[model samples]
Structures are given as structure tokens and as C-alpha cells.
Target: MKGLLLRWLILTLAILAAAYLIDGIAVAGFPSALAAAALLGILNALLRPLLLLLTLPLNILTLGLFTFVINALLLMMVSGVIGGLKIQGFGSALLASLVISLVSWLLTTLVGNEGKMDVIVLQRRDEDHWE
Candidate 1:
């Protein structure tokens, strides 16, 4: 549950960052960004897999490049559903999706699956020798 909320927050921040960086993507404010993020999450959860399955041949044909087109389509859908969020066109949606995905990936890597900072633990035993 906490992890889900953290992911949602990360998505919101990613959306805001994309809007900030992209000229054709506009988010009116934080509320809008939050709403857009939620909508995007829901859409990705419900629609993305279906779309991917349906477009498998195309996806394979392009070596998965078509997935980006599917992402742009989802972004366009979100813009249509959310009033305060606006995406100009397919090109803009594609670029914005790329930025948002990159930001989200970076943030999620920092945050572990349980909504906590990710840390690596190592232990050395007497039987283990240094190289």
C-alpha cells in the first residue's frame, strides 16, 4: 500500500517534470499533475497490456518501437480525460511519455519496492578471501 502511494507520487513528479521540459505538454498545476498521474497509472494498468497484446505483431515487427506509439496513444487518452492536462499532438505525446518514463524509472530505482530507500547489504565470511 505504501509502495503504491510512493509510486503514485513518483508518477506525479515525473508528470510535472515532463510538463516542465516539454513545450507541447501542459499541466495547469500540481493538482492537475496529480490527477494526470493517477489517470496515467490507471490507464497503463488497465489498457496498456491489452494494447500490447493486440499490437504484438506490430511491436515485434518494429522490435518494440511500436510500444512508444502505444505509450503516446495512452498519453493522448489521458489528456482527453483530464481537463487541466493538455497534450498538443502525437509527437508531443511521444516526447512527453519518454521523459516521464525516464524520470519515473530513475525515481523508482532510488525507492525500493516497499516505498523505502533502496540499500545494498554485503557480508564477508572467514571462508571468503579477497581477490
Candidate 2:
């Protein structure tokens, strides 16, 4: 669907931003970034839940910070599988994950879940008054 493609494009942009801002994470090019984003999306959808459930105690102990660790691991997994994407260390992966998550969240918030802008209209009613 259009929404899905928009989300994926946002994610790819996030990945590129992270790679640019971070020192140890390297993306060969836009194609690699696209592939990485797709792989990340698939992994997050298919594997993240299981990892979260398995690491619930740790996640709870860290007040959900361990979720970042899970995300970093997933990034590392993708790096291993993708030749053009390289993450030099766990620290790099963790930082990249954080950056990607933030950028993706910001972009998604701006784009909306449906990938379209919604307009809202408000009208004054008899029971309503300006403060």
C-alpha cells in the first residue's frame, strides 16, 4: 500500500541520516540504505516481539532501555547479512539504532500513519466561549 511504501522511505531516510551522523556506521549508498531499511523493517516485524518477550526481565530491569539493545542487535544482524552496510562495533550499532529510531519517529509523526494529511475544522457552538 501507499502507506507502507511511505513508511519504508521514511525509514530509509532515517538510516541514511544515522549513517551520515555516526562515525562507525557506514552505508555504501542509497541502494544499500534501502535494502537495510527493508531488512530492518522485516526483522522488527518478525523477530522483535520474540526478542522482547525473551528479554522481558532485562527490559523491565532497565526500564525498557534494553529495547535499544535489542534494536542494536537487529542492526548488527542486518549489517552481517548486507555487504554494503557495515557497523564497526556494538556501540556504533546502538547509537545508530537510537538515531534511526528518533528520525523515523519524527518523520512518521509528520507523515501520519495513513501517509496523508488530514484537515480538521472547528466551529463555535452556543455552549462554547473563548477564554
* Residues 7-104 of candidate 2: C-alpha lDDT, one tens digit per residue: 88999999999999999999999999999999999999999999999999999999999999999999999999988899999999999989999999
Candidate 1: C-alpha RMSD after superposition: 3.8
Q: What is the C-alpha lDDT of each candidate?
A: 0.92, 0.93
List ranges where model 1 is wrong by over 4 Å: 119-131
* Model 2 lDDT-worst window of ten: 122-131
Q: Write the per-residue lDDT of candidate 1 for residues 7-90, one digit (tens) a residue.
A: 999999999999999999999999999998899999999999999999999999999989889988998999999999999989
Question: So what's the TM-score on candidate 2?
Answer: 0.87
Clashing pairs in 2: none
Best by lDDT: 2
